[model samples]
Target: MAIPKVFITRRLPEKCIKPLQQVAEVKMWSEEYKPVPREVLLQEVQTSHGLLTMLSDRVDETLLAQAPQLKCVANLAVGYDNIDLEACRLHHVIPCNTPDVLTETTADLVFALLMASGRRLIEANDYLKQGKWQEWGPFLMAGADIHHKTIGIVGMGRIGTAVARRAQGFAMNVIYHNRRRNVEAESELGARFCGFESLLETADFVVNLIPYTETTKGLFNQNAFTKMKKTALFINAGRGATVDEDALYQALLEGEIAGAGLDVFSQEPIPKEHPLLTLEQVVALPHIGSASVETRKQMISLCCKNLMRTLAGEKPITPIETSR
Candidate 1:
């Protein structure tokens, strides 16, 4: 009998690949930075039994239709928006994501970015590096304060709850808006449930942790930004498309909102000339939410294990519900 085959979209650790190798023939795209070309990925799925993909890869209806033998997809990141879950269900393909393992790490990054933007950490460092820190004034690099301020989290999942815990340590008032109320988060974290519009108006720091979905796409348009206080800070650690990029830029430009700290953008590796990058008030990162060393290794391990389990006629470790 021919060994089952698995195609990995990007290079993973040798140790992570070893276990998959024992059960199947493994093929990997050797680059770490470049995404596998769409044509190449389609060609690979023709015969592969399982696929290990990253957020950069698109596993859509068109690709799924061509992959007759493919049984499982283990997405390395916690978000599976890149994959078409409905298509997977129609094709009888199981999709899994590396969640829980990266929640704390991502939450850590959210707080880091919040602090960086609120306190002007990056701007201050650049000022000193440019030899422009000759003298100090009372407000030389002064920025917003995090303590005892209201923080309205847009999503209340594992990562959101973790972020609320961090907000607690800072003594910030935690409020949240979710599709459904999360009682545990309310009781344990002292989070108050509120409507989306209300949250926007009241929160001193408006943080978005919501996942991307059809309903959430372009949710933060001009109207949403206009509703926020001119003194409010906007932070997004969630998917980029959730907020309208153009609207966000205008908000920063017009002082409709104070500033923004964004880890994800509508386009990855945003162009240097992108309007958002030009603003001193905008703190942009390259979507490194779960990028801690230990968390990355754990995500890889979870993804590999999920793929292996699904191929061996067992359930995936963190299967996504296609019914949504």
Candidate 2:
């Protein structure tokens, strides 16, 4: 019998790929930064039994139809929004995502972004680097205070709950809104479940950790921003499409909200000419929420394990429920 073949969309650290190599013939795109071209991915999947994909790769009906032998798709990130799970289901291919492993790591970033935006750390750094600090003034670079403030978290999932735990350390009050209430977070973390509009109205820091779905797309719009405290700081570590970028820009421009720290955008590799980047009040990061070395390696390993197990006719460790 021919050995099962697996294709990895991007070049990963050799150590993480080694275990999979032992189980199947492994092929990887040579470039680390560049995504595999669509043509290349389609061509390679024609002969592949499994695939390890990045969020940048689109695993839709188009790709699925070409991949006749594909048994599994192990997405490298926790969110499987990039993959067409329904398509995978119809094709009888299991879809897996790296979850739980990066929850805390991503939570750490959410808190950091919250702090950076509240304190204007990025702006201050730029001011000093630009040689604008001629004298120390009491009001110079004054920013929002995080301690003892109310933090409203949208989406009380693994990462959201992890962020609530961190909020406890700083003595901040936590309030959350989810599709359904998370009673554990309410009892253990002292989080209060509130209506979405009320959370927007009250939180000193509105931290968006909601995922992207048709329902959540553009959930944070102009009205949502207007509902927030004029002094509020917004932090988005969630899927970018959850916010209307144009509306967010207008909000900051008109002082509907104070500032924002963003780790993701509606578009990946957000163009340099994007209007949001022009705002000094906005601190933008390149979707590095789970970028810590230790956590990233763990995510990669989990993806490898999922792919290996599925190709071997075993259940995946974290299969996504496509029906939802």
Candidate 3:
């Protein structure tokens, strides 16, 4: 009898991957930064009983149909938008993802990005390094303040709520807009529920923490930015498709909004000449929202556990349920 096989999309740490090796034959793509090619991924899954994927990999109908023996898919990230949950359900392939583990770490990064952009830290640092600081001057490289300001969170899910909790330490007034009201966020976190439009108009910092879906794609258009305060800072730590980049660039260029701090972009490895990169008011990062070394290992461990559990005929730790 042929031993069961497992395909890992990227090279993971050996210590975290050791657990999965004991359960099945493990085959991992060698490159650290590069994703497995579509043809290669599809070929590997044909003989795989379990597949460990990254957000960069798309596990759609075509891939799943070819993966006749694939019993489970474990995604290393919190969001599984890359995988068609409905397709996985139809194929009877259980899907799982690592969630909650990176919540606090991601929230920390978002707030750091917010402060870095708001205070012009990166811009001022670059200016000083370029020998532009000739003399001490008042209000030099001045930017917006965060204390006692209204922070409107677009999504009040686990990560969003974590961000709101941190905002409490900064004395920020938290307002949030979600599909449904989160009573815990309202009472415990001191967050007020508000409409989407109302939050944009009132907030000093407007944060997009929502997921990407049909309703959320391009949600932040020119009209939405126009509703925001001229002094408000826009921050997106959510999925990239949630905001319209053209609208964001126009907003920053025309001073419709104060500035922006972006982690995820519409394109992965966003082109260096991207319009958003041209703005001094925009602080951009290479999608490092949950890049902490410790948290990443935990995430890998979670995925490994999820895959191993399914292979062992046990329920996954954080299974994603779908019925489509």
Q: List, residue by residue over 80-147, the lDDT tens digit for candidate 1.
A: 89999889999999999988999999999999989998999999999999999998899999999999
User: Highest lDDT, which number?
Assistant: 2
Q: Write the per-residue lDDT of candidate 2 for residues 113-158, one digit (tens) a residue.
A: 9999999999999999999999999999999989999999999999
> Candidate 3 residues 42-92, lDDT tens each?
899999999999999999999999999999999989888899999998999
After superposition of all CA atoms, the RMSD between model 3 and the true structure is: 0.9
* Model 1: lDDT of residue 33: 85
TM-scores, all candidates, are: 0.98, 0.99, 0.99
lDDT of each: 0.93, 0.95, 0.94
Runs with alpha carbons beyond 4 Å of true place in candidate 1: none
Shift of residue 296 alpha carbon in model 2, Å: 0.8
* Winner on TM-score (1 vs 2): 2
